[model samples]
Target: MKKLFVLFCLTSILISCKKEKTTENNDDTGTSRAHSEWNDFGLKGNVKSTLEYTTEEKKDGGNTSSVRKFENQFSPDIALKFDNKGKLINKISYKENGNVAEDIVYDGKDKMISKRNFTTATEYVETKYTWEGDKNTIIARRFNGSRLLDKEVFQYNNGRLVEHYKYDGNEKQANRTSFSYDDNNRVSEESYFRNKPTMQTRLSIEYDDNGNKTSEIYYDKNFKVISKTNSVYNSYNQMLTSQTFTDNGSLDVELSRTYDDKKRLITKESFEVYDNSKNKEEFEYDQNDNTTVWKVYKNGKLVSETVYKYDFKNNLIYQIVTDGKGNEIYNKQIEYTYDDNNNWIGKKTTVNNIVFYTSRKIEYY
Candidate 1:
């Protein structure tokens, strides 16, 4: 599905901020002191990443598996530049075969300004974003070589996104989506269309007194009911159960959940459509608040189990998946190397002994 460009930009911004920080060199004298002081000074920085893979043969119990081997590693496939506050300003995505795929540039305000997508050695698609009036309204234009493909406009009202309209190259409206909110400032209805004045689908939602969602109804283009879902929540605003109904108002499926005192979900049971079978998922956490065991059951019979092991830093470093009767199906181990700042700079993973490695070069602020 085509995603909204603004959402993509927002996600990029978040990822840029959460990137792990490391040193440019291993020397811990002057270089280490400089990096430590830079953290106090709030300096701008960038990150470079490389990924490599290798295959190995392994025997678990009496079974064996073959792994696909890629001929080359993706060296320095991605480069990202960030501002002082860690907002993404520029991104260059490279193809697996070591070719530039796209270059995304962001404005000083952290809004994506333009993206260049490479189609051929000499051909490309260029998309530009334009903003107006306090940056609440945005227009995006896409071009393939010299030909315009489509244009889209996003509109916001009272700091809430309300509508998005898509137009053809000739500037004719092709599709649009509208959002409506309730008194509690929660989205109450949404409608979408593929062509002007033609409705495709609509969704309406109802909320409880505490502003928790209670029911959601979906409608087809012809205004016929497609499905209805009803949810029941506890006083803490946590969902306890939910039921989905078919167009004829018949129960289609149901789900129930149980949580511990920490509000962590412990068990989830699903009632299949038109079936009495109940599939369940159970979780167990360790002292570090990491899920150590995850089990899945079908019709009250254990089907599979996954165990997780973490390092002293609470970083998940090992995982083992087994079927019922304790037969190992998959195993993975991860190791990490940290920088002076205690940030992971290198990560290596081995799945059934087939190794994959990723290295990051981070400049700290």
Candidate 2:
């Protein structure tokens, strides 16, 4: 089986903005302030990062297990410039740690072009895409290393995305994905296929009154339900309930949550994934209601636990994890600094005292 690690760090860097806000009160953020201050005062510097991972088995009646750590570092430099339309333009980023991350480019218009990426000692690699379009069609080129592989095409109506066509590494149409949107501009349904949509499976999405994602249901091409998920939320929009169903609409798994007066999540019950089904995960908070530790228990067995440390700004600074044997398996340390302009100018990451990566932000007027 394959696993996807959507690490918070990865998501934060790639996806900066949220599609919805839980409440208007939380909108008094300092993004604009930081941006303005950074612009007026101008900021430039370096930032660095590192990651450490570990896991251990928990034994009944035994202490937490020993923690073993693996670490890696990534560092980069960011420089900012402006285009004719006054839109910010990103130039080259030199990754000091040999990580060739994605680079963003703009045409000073509506299009954004992303460059290709190469790999390391792996058995395979891929280049990137080249696109050309007007108001209706987009053509993309795929490549392997320096060789052209295949092409992908997209057709749209008005500003609504309608269809996607993907080809092989050599430009053969391999798959197509079509999309449908609701009146509120939310993606209501989607279908995917090899060469075209299949009658086997289609997907639908739903949202609640506060605009929070409420559910996703997948149906076979025969219109028979395949799998469905239901979601619940708190005032902060944090997930409170998650229920999964099988084709017969039978509950396959479910989770529920509880929060404190400050709306901070305090505990969760998971009746799935293992035996003794009605296990629970507990979280403890500090005076400020910040989550300090999390614990998972199954049949009175301690399975997992984690502790977090935070800085004055409420930014996470460090994390520690352990198994039932009391072994420290995962430890991560991160720190950030800003200039007078409030621009985050530097970052540091470490795993068990081994520095993995760091980065600096360079700014220009």
Candidate 3:
């Protein structure tokens, strides 16, 4: 099915705060840290460096019935270096053979300044970013050796991104996007133009008095509505229902969710009008609000269930999945080794009796 909400997706990216930390906490390894301090890397406590690698047992076939062989040695996957404040400074990713695949560098402000991707032993692509005096990025240029490949230029209004333009290697305009904000400082409209000033598509958003997004409308170049989505929120500002309609005003998809008193999602239900299919998911959480059980139902019939087990430190240690008939389909168990700061350094995961190990060498400031 053709997704009619493409414009909404672009608006979201253009409106979000650039410095906001988008990374989720690492609960599986019990590595807990302040979001602001860790930024988007999710590092734990004053970490200076980290090297991660994994090892897997060899098997005759890629199936559970295959004969297991000796386990391979750990192959380096990634290496990261952080500054005294726990901000990532450098990162290197490796290929399966332990060859450097990509190297990325970040500035003091934790903004990525350059990335070099190794395509082969002698060939690479380099991309560089230029910021506008500690504000939004002004330009990004990609190069193949010394030859310019493409570039993007950004314009801002009072620190908010207002326009973005893309150009080909020859400096010819490829496309452009412009944004407008509402009285609340939220992006209320976005327009896209392809190689010309004529808008090809547009998206408009509406918000409630409490700043909750209430609806989004997609429009074509003629400003005719292509699709519309309406949302309902509870007193806590939690979205309770979202429904999308087609150009003809026919319901396309409807999603409803219920949350606990703590604002954690407890149940979600979705229906697709085209296929007449209904699906539901129920969630159970532990005292710490960690998800412990998840059950899926199709057309009101139970289909699958999953259970999660966590350690005393709130690190996920085990998980099992079963079919509706209660037959075990998948099982996994993890054993962790932690450091004095309670950060896990090593972990062994066994899935369906097949073992895989991952190790992390972390240096703290």
Candidate 4:
């Protein structure tokens, strides 16, 4: 469900300029410059734009090498195009059967301005944005065929998002979120609401000197304690233990983690108030920091295990899971193709013999 929601915003794929810096400049042309942003996405840089198309096919169990299409699926056959700055510009969505569904356009600032739905054969929605100075903060008004649906007013402080207020069609405050940041520029507290000035939930967090989260507290609308979690870390700043307590001060859940000499997580054990079952998981990583194997245990006995394999480019290529007795439970294989810049341009995955493919067309400035 969370992944589906993120699809609408492409939130996870957005690059943070503050955390990235150019790493290399190829010759004097400036066209083949390499940067940390490329490494972040498993590419070799020089990428200017990208257009991704994704689709899937299910195998016909009755016949081998045969497949059929359906109307409803996990993701529509949508093409997402991003500019040189990695900002999404145009999104063309197609129905499961390959017919145009919608076409969305974004402005130079990467703000959605219009969306037309082919099925409806009309403009579904249009948005107008009013910026606040030079910051990314803006007030966005959404319209459904000239009828105002809602407006979102965003506030930022020192380049950090501080608050957002949403108003419904009637121009009444519908919901809002407020954030407070610590000295380290990390969010220290967050509050949510369904109505203006009325908080539904609030979360307060504390961190150690090493920037590791030390504690978190959840509060109800009335600021009553809902739950509290405390974390203990080793000298290496790795979490050694975590305990969560209920509002009544009862230990609700506890987790103990063990790490290898290289500071890699090796095992994790969990305990809960109701079940107290000995649930544990062990992990082994490859040289590339990828988890190569994972073992699950119950009552000190191994229940299942999973093995992962990656290609030379550090792409996960295969995964296999088996029961305690070594009976195969699940398996998947993936293949990929890369461009001259070492950027992945195509991907194919087979799960239980059902294939899915995703292809990308990239352009450079």
The model with the greatest lDDT is 3
Q: Can you write out model 4's per-residue Cα lDDT over 1-365, one digit (the tens) per residue?
A: 34433331131112110122234655223544342233334444444556556666644676535232321344455555555644456778766555667777764424565665554544465556565555545444444457777888888877888998888888898889999999899989999987956789999999998988899999999899999999999999989999999999999999999999889999999988878777999989877666788888887888777777777766767777777889876666778898876667887866656676777787754
lDDT of 3 by residue, 1-365 (tens): 01212322232222221232324554334454444345444445667888877666556666533221212222236788877755678898776655677888887535788888988866778888888787646455555557878888888889888999999888899999999999889999999998877999999999999999899999999998899999999999999999999999999999999999899999999999999999999989888666788888989998877787777766667777777899887676778898875667887877678786768898976
Any residue pairs clashing in model 4, and if so which? Answer: none
Q: What is the C-alpha RMSD of each candidate to the true structure, in Å?
A: 8.5, 9.3, 7.6, 6.5
Best by the TM-score measure: 3
- lDDT against the true structure, per candidate, is 0.68, 0.56, 0.74, 0.69
Cα displacement (angstroms), candidate 2, residue 73, comes to 5.3
* lDDT minimum window of 10 residues, candidate 1: 41-50
* Best-to-worst ranking by TM-score: 3, 1, 4, 2
Per-residue lDDT tens digits for candidate 2, residues 139-207, read 444444455566667776767778888777677678888899988987899887756445447899999
Give the residue spans of candidate 3 off by over 4 A: 1-44, 58-76, 108-110, 138-145
Report the lDDT of model 2 for residue 125. Answer: 38
Clashing pairs in 1: 39-365
Off by over 4 Å in 4: 1-39, 48-95, 99-152, 156-164, 176-204, 219-224, 234-238, 298-303, 337-339, 343-348, 355-365
RMSD of 2: 9.3
Better of 2 and 3 by lDDT: 3
Tens-place lDDT digits, model 1, residues 1-365: 12322332232233222322334532233333333222321222222222222333446799875443321232234566655444556777666554667888875424778888888655778888776644635555556635778888888888777998888888888999999998888899999887958779999999999999899999999899999999999888989999999999998999999998888889999997777888999989876567778887989898777787777665667777777779876676778887665555676767665765655566644
